[model samples]
Target chain A: MGGVITGVDLLATAVFAVSGALAAAEERNDILGFILFGTITGIGGGTLRDLLLGADSVFWLYQNEYLWVCLGASLATWFLAPQFNSLQKLLLWADAVGMALFSVLGAVKAIQLGAPAVVAIGMGVMSATFGSLIRDTFLNRTPVLLAPEIYVTAAMVGAVSYTLLAFFEVVEAIALPLAILFGFGLRACAIIFDLRLPKYGDGR
Target chain B: MGGVITGVDLLATAVFAVSGALAAAEERNDILGFILFGTITGIGGGTLRDLLLGADSVFWLYQNEYLWVCLGASLATWFLAPQFNSLQKLLLWADAVGMALFSVLGAVKAIQLGAPAVVAIGMGVMSATFGSLIRDTFLNRTPVLLAPEIYVTAAMVGAVSYTLLAFFEVVEAIALPLAILFGFGLRACAIIFDLRLPKYGDGR
Candidate 1:
């Protein structure tokens, strides 16, 4: 990867790490828990994705910067936690943005690894959801993905759309942003309209 | 690995999986939870160790038989859960057996990957502890390793012993059993005499 693209990835990862720490804080966990949550949330999904792809090494292990980024993000959040608790909705937007970026990136990575289409789809979901799932486990709570929300579905939309673009021979730059936008837009729209999936009690 | 070695590994893994499923059952969780706990507790530690050492693809993914072992062990425990729960004291012996074997195996794998001693130490502990940590996470219980009960210390002892034997060019057939004996002995001692690290709250 080039220097500029790597820089962008770093900033995006910081956002995800902060979201993770914030989630731990919401549960009133301690400092070690916050750091653990931040690191897992930041790198957990990508680690699984890379392992499956047979990439050189898990990205964070090769690059020390990611560790520092997660640690810094965790500490910063710890310091500013009291003030930010009031703006919970704002944190949701940050999480959505990170999810969009990660979800598309996952699909792109799987394509790069030459996995079959369905495997790519699975990788995409793994990339977007594994971290939060791990974080929830540590907090002893059910994962948001398993709880029936606009979670994995949003990533599926992102991955499927991205795969279609690649199928159509779109430019890398164009396809990446398009997938991110589609994922984020759908998630945002769902939140704004409270669009939840119908459950057992709902009429067919 | 040779056929005989592979057979022994599978047998040990089956015993460990049975212990994990029984642990979950004792907690009174459902069948799905039992399977989840059994599988993760059985394989996750080794997978983590492999990833860290950059070993070949995880053992479970390549070998369908390993998955079947975990599934079978989980099912068997789920059905006869009450019978096994009475054997909790004995089940701890099974865990110790798994930890001992896994620690030496992990160190050997790390050496194969050309990792240094510290990395190998990390791998050994990871192999012994990762699954139980994952299991505890799902059960919303604090991890036993985190309790500082000389658990990882015992794994490290076995790992370092294995490393020294490998360095001295000792035969693996002799060295591995010695390492396993060392670890299992430590754990059995800890459990039998109720030995634990002193805590500040214990009025020391």
Candidate 2:
């Protein structure tokens, strides 16, 4: 069970790492910048969550595989940049998958650690989105999560769903997959339809 | 002994919270933005350090006094802005003092946790500047630490000085004040003389 969870975690981390490296490439940053962005983005969200949850150490520090995976993904992205024509779409899909996986993972961890439901959901959203926030800040762009998109909303919905399932004593195996699916499906639809939640605009 | 250290910590948190609130006010952000930025800036650097050092939880999260101090500072800034003509100068000095105090505190904590000197110094630098980094990112400006200012350099120098003193068996009473003095003095000079390190300009 732990091995399967770790597998999903590493997969999400690798995907986010690639997204971060691609962002660095788009910004015309150098090699060091690519690696820095990739490593930070891959672990940023989980690090914040662990810190908030009072975990002794961050996950990546204890798990060498996560760091190596991020490095490999970054190097691959850097080397393949010229041929990668659909960078934006690729980033979107990769980020969506990462968001889904991490949200479920974060919520599960927070709940197990005895956080209230609301706090657990908040952790899930933070875990899903903060890496991208850091990436955007480093690249001198507004964070996409702060945009009027269905991004964070998708994560929140999934976290709530997971929490409800757990409250009803659903097995971890069933709850986890369904949570990821719901989050990913919402995000994919948002991408396909360009969906966005309403925002407070300038008064007409 | 612990009382004095806690006092200094709370003082630094309050001062940085004021700086963050002032920034939000300058940007004409809402009340929530003022509080949010204030709380984040006050705790951001320390949070990063504790996470890196594998602390069970963030310091502010464990101590409610820190959060209350931040909130009070932000509220004071919000109400006092109209009458405060020396906001910029005030911000500079408060920030310098806060940077000095946080650098020493972060270094001390990391050292106590058995981190190497280099890692302790890095934590010091991170603690002194990361709050402002977050503040600048949110306000859509470049972080001062990223500029060729004497800012992060001051913290690094102080951290190194403190580590060497501690390693040499100097008492905390003597080492702490000297470290803070070195950091604050350098930052004050930088502010007074507009001193900055040379930039990597595209030389002709």
Candidate 3:
């Protein structure tokens, strides 16, 4: 179970790293900026999650693979961003995948760490959203979480679904995939359909 | 020693919470936003410091006093913002004091947690600045840390000062006041004189 989850986590990290690199490219930052943004975006969410959960050490500090993955993806994007058309949409979809995976993974970890159900869900949403939040803040842009989007909602659904499934005695193998699908499906739909939640003053 | 340090910590938290409330008032956000911003800004730095140092839990979560202090300050600000002309400058000085105290305290805690000197210094800077980082991020403004100020430099100097003093067997009674004075003094001078570090692209 750990092996499977670790594989998914790395994939998510890579996707978010690419998104971060692309954001840096859009800002016309140099190689150092690319690496910094990528690494932060890749690991920022999990780092916050681990910290909030009182983990002994951050995941990347304990194991170097996450750092390497972020750097590798950053370097790759530094060379590829100029040639890529439609970078924005690509970033959105990739970010959606990362968000889905991280949300479920964070919730699982929090539950294992003895967090209450609601706290686990909140951690899940935070883990899914905070990396992008950091990236956007660094770029001096409004974070996607602050925007009215299906992003955080998808993470909540993923977390809640996984928690409910676990409560029903479902195996990890079955629960993880279903939760990922539920979150990814919602986020993908949002991207495809330009879905948005109503603004507070919109009178909808 | 612990008693004195805790007093300084709570004072800083109250000051920062007021600043946070003022920031929310500037944005015309409602009561909920004021409370949320106040609470996060008040404790955000120490939370980051503990996480970076791999502490068991955040300070506010371990003890409830910090939360209450933040809440009290926020509530006060909610009722007082309109009549409190000149909030901006007041926030600046209060925040300067906060930066000073948190920087030294964070460094001390990191060293006590067995981190090396350089890492401790970095944590010190993080603890001083990250609360404002969070506040500015939420409010969609660039953070002071990235604004080419003498702010982070002051925090660094304080951390280094305290660490060296402790290394030389200086008692906390002597060291803590000196460190805080060092940081706060530098920051106050910067604010008074409109001091700034040389910008990267200034071509000077």
Most accurate candidate by DockQ:
3
Residue lDDT tens for model 2, A25-96: 878889988998998889888887876888767788878999999999999989987786888778778888
**Candidate 2 residue runs with Cα over 4 Å from true position:** A1-11, A14-18, A21-44, A47-86, A114-125, A137-142, A145-204, B14-40, B51-94, B107-126, B133-140, B146-204
lDDT of 3 by residue, B28-99 (tens): 555545665787788888887776676677766446688779878988887776666776777777788888
**How well does candidate 3 match the true structure in TM-score terms?**
0.62
- Which candidate, 1 or 3, has the higher lDDT? 3
DockQ for each model: 0.12, 0.15, 0.17
Per residue, candidate 2 scores C-alpha lDDT tens digits across B1-204 of 678888988998998998888776665554545665687788777778877777776665546687789878988887776576766677777788888989888888888888899988988888998888887786676666775558988888778888888899898889989988998889888888888887667454
**What does the TM-score come to for chain B in model 2?**
0.93
Superposed Cα deviation of residue A59, candidate 3 (Å): 2.4
Q: Clashing residue pairs in candidate 1, if any? A: none
Candidate order, DockQ descending: 3, 2, 1
Residue pairs with backbone atoms closer than 3 Å in model 2 (clashes): none
Better of 1 and 2 by DockQ: 2
| Candidate 1 residue-wise lDDT, B1-204, digit = tens | 456456756766776787778678768878987787888888877778667546557888879898898899889877776654365664577777877777777787777666666556545755776666676766667655444355766777778888888788888788778877887788778777766654212331
Q: How high is the lDDT of residue B120 in model 2? A: 85
Evaluated on CA atoms against the true complex, candidate 2 attains a DockQ of 0.15
